[model samples]
Target: MDYFIQQLINGITLGGVYALIALGYTMVYGVIQLINFAHGEFFAAGGYMGVILLNWFIGRGYMSTHPMICIGASVVLTMGYCAFLAMGVEKIAYKPLRSASRLAVLLSALGMSIFLQNAMMLTQGVFDKPYPIELAEGSLTVGGITVSYLQVIIVVFTVVLLVGLNLLVFKTRIGMAMRATAQDKVMSSLVAISSNRIISLTFAVGAGLAAAAGIMVGFYYGSVRYDMGFVPGIKAFAAAVLGGIGNITGAMLGGLIIGMVEVFGAGYISGQYKDVFAFIILIAVLYFKPTGIMGENVDDTRV
Candidate 1:
């Protein structure tokens, strides 16, 4: 039971990160029907940006820190920069292909992914960068199971993010625009809704969330690499799909489930092939519920 609890905590932390990153994929797909394959790279980019900012700020005495202050600054800066990056990507690679076939947009996304990976490698060089956070370590015990400070932070932050997302999607004007755009772009445009702006906003939101996940991973795992986005990106994509690709709530639930499954699988089964567990779940979910847990593939409902 203790072991099970430990695995559960571990899974939740991993799941939180996955869910955060997966939100971008699901959101972009929800409205645009195109997977921004390069979305993952945005995670890596955000991490690098945060670390660089941290180093510069600290080096120049522009910032001093209590642990909380440092973390807050990193989080805010990372989110802003990533949001900008997302908007830029949408304006450049995606907006032009909005009127084109889905295949064209998808191919363009793949192109962006490749370009980013290569660009990061060329520019950042090949190395694993250290985390800027100097986190205080402690563990909280619940039901005889202990979870570390990092794990707790990951879970809490994820919950806050998901709650904020829920409010954003279900309670706001922009959310309505997003749903309207997702349901039918032509109709949305006819009604004076700027589908372009909504789509750009979607990408920006997704990028910001993914960057937050990247920040958490950087602090918890202790290193960030240029190619780090690939695995987490793929896993988060699986989470998005499992939850119901276009459903925001579904994405969140799926991420937690996937995280738990992978963690438990690694702990109890073989750590070497931990990744296979998510794919296996994905396959099973696909076979049973092709539209996803919360996804309405053919439904025309708007928020």
Candidate 2:
């Protein structure tokens, strides 16, 4: 039972990270109907930025005197950096192809992904960048089960972000604008909602969330690599599809399910096949429910 609980906690932490990344996929798809393949590059970029910022803080002697504040600042700065990066990518790579064929836009996204990935490799080097181990050193143990402080922080932060997103989408005027634009870009533009701005905002918001995840993942794993985003990005994409792309709630649920499956599969079976288990579940969901769990009501739930 303790083992199960331990694994469950791990699963939730992993799932939350996936869900954060998945939101980028679903949100971009919801608004523009285009899958931003470069979304994962934003995640990778965030990880690198976090390390760089934290190291800078350490060099300036801020980390020793104010560890929590330094970390908080790093997260905020990294997120903002990625958000701007996403907006820039949208303007440069996707904007011109807005009216082009879907294939053209998709190809552009793929090319951008490759370009960004290579750019990171060239700028940050191909080696793994290690996060400061001191940032997440402690763990709490109870009843023979151990839970890391980093896990708790990840889960709490995920919940806070999720709830904040819900309020943004359901309560605020901006959210209403988002929903309206998602429903009908032309109609929303007729109302002076500025579809282009909303689209850019969507990209910024999604990239910001993915950036946060990247920072958290770096803290959790103690290091990051330029190519680290590829596998997790694929898994998060799978999670988005399983949960019904464009449905926020479905994405969260799908991420949790995927996370749980991967953790349990690794714990009980072979660790080497964990990725296989995650994909198998994704394939099964695709076969049985192509529209996804919440995708049946896409018009109502999108954005």
Candidate 3:
């Protein structure tokens, strides 16, 4: 039972990160029907940004005096940087291809992914960049099971982010415009909604979420790497597909499920095939129900 509880905690923590990254994929897909394969790079960039900012703070001696402030600054700056970067990517790489074929857009996204990966490698090098400070220290133990403070922070932040996203999507005027654009671009244009702006906003928001996830992962794992986005990106894509490609709630559900599956599979079965669990579930879902668990209208999503 204790073992189960421990694995469960670990799974939840991992899921929180997955859910954040998955949100980026799902949101971009939801808004413009583009996969934005480069989204993972945004995650990597965010991690690097966080570490850079945090390290600067540490060097200036601000971290020891004001750790919380330093952390907050890093999160804000990293998210902002990544959000703007994603917006620029959309404008430069994706905007011109809007009228092009889906295949062309897909290829462009892939190309951009490679470009960003190489850019990060050239700039940050191929080595792992260690975080300068630990935001959460120690752990809480209960019933012979232990949970780290970092895990608690990650889960809580994820829940808060999910709630905030729900409000943004369902309650805001911008969100309504986004939904309209997603449902029917022509009709949305006729209704005086600027689809281009909405689409850009969607990318920015998704990138912000991905950035947050990247920073959390850096703190959790103690280091960030230029190529760190690849695996989690793929897993998050799988999670998005499992939940429903364009569905926000579905993305969250899928992320949690994938996290649990991977963690439990590793704990009870074998760590060697941990990634295989998510892939198997993805394949199974695609074979059985391609539309996903809570998915509706495979093309258009309420996100």
Top-lDDT candidate index: 3
- lDDT of all predictions, in order shown? 0.86, 0.90, 0.91
**Native-referenced Cα lDDT, model 1:** 0.86
lDDT of 3 by residue, 1-303 (tens): 888889999999999899999999998888888788999999999999999999899999998998888899999999999999999999988999999998899899899999999999999989999988777899998879999898999899889989998899999998889888878999999989998999999999999999999999999999999999988998898899899988999999999999999999999999999989999998998888877888886733322
RMSD of each: 2.7, 2.3, 2.0
**Which runs of model 1 end up more than 4 angstroms from their true locations?**
62-67, 141-144, 299-303
- Which parts of model 2 have CA positions greater than 4 angstroms off? 297-303
Task: List the candidates ranked by lDDT, beginning with the highest.
Answer: 3, 2, 1
Task: List candidate 3 stretches off by more than 4 Å.
Answer: 299-303
lDDT for each residue of candidate 2 in 91-210, tens digit (9 for 90 to 100): 988999989998899899889999999999999999999997456768999988999887988999999998988899889999999999988999999999999999999999999999
Determine which window of 10 residues in candidate 1 has minimal summed lDDT.
Answer: 294-303
Per-residue error for 252 in candidate 3, Å, reads 0.5
Candidate 3: pairs in clash: none
Error of 3 at 240 (Å): 0.7
Tell how far residue 91 is off in model 1, in angstroms: 1.8
Clashing pairs in 2: none
Writing each residue's lDDT as its tens digit, candidate 1 over 221-298 gives 887889999988888888999999988888888899989989988999999999999999888877887778887764
Candidate 1 all-Cα RMSD: 2.7
